[model samples]
Target: MVDLRALFSSNDPVGSAEAFTNRQNQWGLVATAIEDHLRHIADPGFNVEDLETSRNNVVHFHGVGGVGKSTLLRKIEASLTAADQRPTQ
Candidate 1:
């Protein structure tokens, strides 16, 4: 988790912005279950290798609305970006 309070300052807006950008690029926040689930699905052992192979590198998350779907996608995107992996559109 990030301490947004630390981002506020009476001075040094440039410095704060830089720090925030750096933290955004790095995985400074704690891991959430969504990230763990993505990693697990990517791992061949978690789901059968055959099943994953059949899917041809695809995964989907289905849930009711207002259940953090966008948040989950953003977290996954951040994780992939941190790992230098591009998320498919």
Candidate 2:
């Protein structure tokens, strides 16, 4: 059986990258949204008017407690951090 103590011991939701798993669909959704947002912002003709019928830059994740919601968010944050540190082409 898995131990809950180890998971709860750390203040960090995700203990490490290795501990995060099985959320490829969620990750893909978030990553795509972020990429689209960045691409839109980088466009010279992009304006707030363009979002009139769009998602308004919001992505929501909802589930019962202790279902790895925080963990998923932390993993996304880590991914974004790693991406930010990479050299731009």
Candidate 3:
């Protein structure tokens, strides 16, 4: 379950990370799409044609209000931020 206070609070980054819950499938899809996009850009051997037909460049999340859309975005942002800070190679 999501922790509502942490979801709504901008001051608590750690709390927000902890509050995010139960969207492993969605997160996995997003992560895979991101990886594919990066590969398309970075890998000379990767077929750009395949990416044109096989994957979408955008991940759209649509649902009624108050269903944790904002919270999920926050989680994605935190994850990407952490990944960006990691040492490469």
**Top candidate when judged by lDDT against the true structure:** 2
**Please, what are the lDDT tens digits per residue for candidate 3 over residues 1-89?**
75766555544444434534588888888899899889777878667666455655788998644555677777777767767674332
Error of 3 at 63 (Å): 0.6
Greater lDDT among 2 and 3 belongs to: 2
Worst 10 residues of 2 by lDDT: 11-20
Decreasing lDDT order of the candidates: 2, 3, 1
Candidate 2 ranges with C-alpha deviation above 4 Å = 1-21, 47-55, 82-89
TM per candidate:
0.31, 0.58, 0.54
Return whichever of 1 and 3 wins on TM-score: 3
Could you give candidate 1's per-residue lDDT for residues 1-89 as a string of tens digits? 43445434333233322332333322333345446657868776765645534543345565444334455556668656845566554
Residue lDDT tens for model 2, 8-87: 66554543444446888888889899999899788897776654655557889985445577777776667667776743
* Number of clashes recorded per candidate: 0, 0, 0
lDDT of each: 0.48, 0.69, 0.68
Clashing pairs in 2: none
User: What is candidate 1's TM-score against the reference?
Assistant: 0.31
